[model samples]
Target: MYFTPALLAAVATVIGLATATPVPEPQGIAAGSIELCTGQYLQGRCTTITTPTGTCVEFPRGFHNDVSSVSGLEGWNCNLYHDDHCTSASYYVQGEQDTLPTDNFNSVICTPPP
Candidate 1:
């Protein structure tokens, strides 16, 4: 196959636009992984979730009582973003996490080990 700079640029543009999501949506999601959650999973009351899997998980658009603090389980690490699409800066969280930088997040991205 042959490639061109113009072609690459076009592809990049398409991908960028396609990936852009509103602040209420998530950009990336992990699949089939061991994850742990306590004290609210998705705007609900304090609860725990294990071995969670999904295409993507997005928090509420604004503040929420449950969007704060997260800890991974069994070698699971995740990234928290302040934007809905995980496009903004990221806050990494792993085992025994109880607090976030902003006490709330817009998105969470996690992937299982290779």
Candidate 2:
């Protein structure tokens, strides 16, 4: 077997990346949601976003507001729904925010890019 310096470097790089945990860096709302936020929201701040693996979730204040605005920071895209279990999904938007019918969304589902 022959070992090239370039090949060795490439292998090391791949190994490093594969072992890295994404829980530290910010992956925006969706990945953030998946990693820790859901449980927090469900259990009342189970973790704080300041923690390396923690995240935050926020919702708007009362009546005069609608979820008329949504954002998919860092290419995040999701289907906002007025009902649970992802019924009636909103259109997909990326690298920018999405808007929904005023204050209507109650649940959301994330979809990978095609």
Which has the greatest TM-score?
1
| TM-score per candidate | 0.48, 0.37
Q: lDDT score, residue 48, model 1?
A: 38
- Residue-by-residue lDDT tens digits, candidate 1, 16-101: 99995867657454453323232443232333333334334565333332455565655666776776677778787756566555
lDDT for predicted candidate 2 compared with the true structure:
0.42
- Runs in model 2 lying further than 4 Å from the true structure: 1-65, 98-101, 112-114
- Candidates in order have lDDT scores of 0.56, 0.42
Clash totals for all models, in order?
Answer: 0, 2
C-alpha displacement of 50 in model 1, angstroms?
A: 8.4
- Cα deviation at 43, candidate 1, in Å, is 13
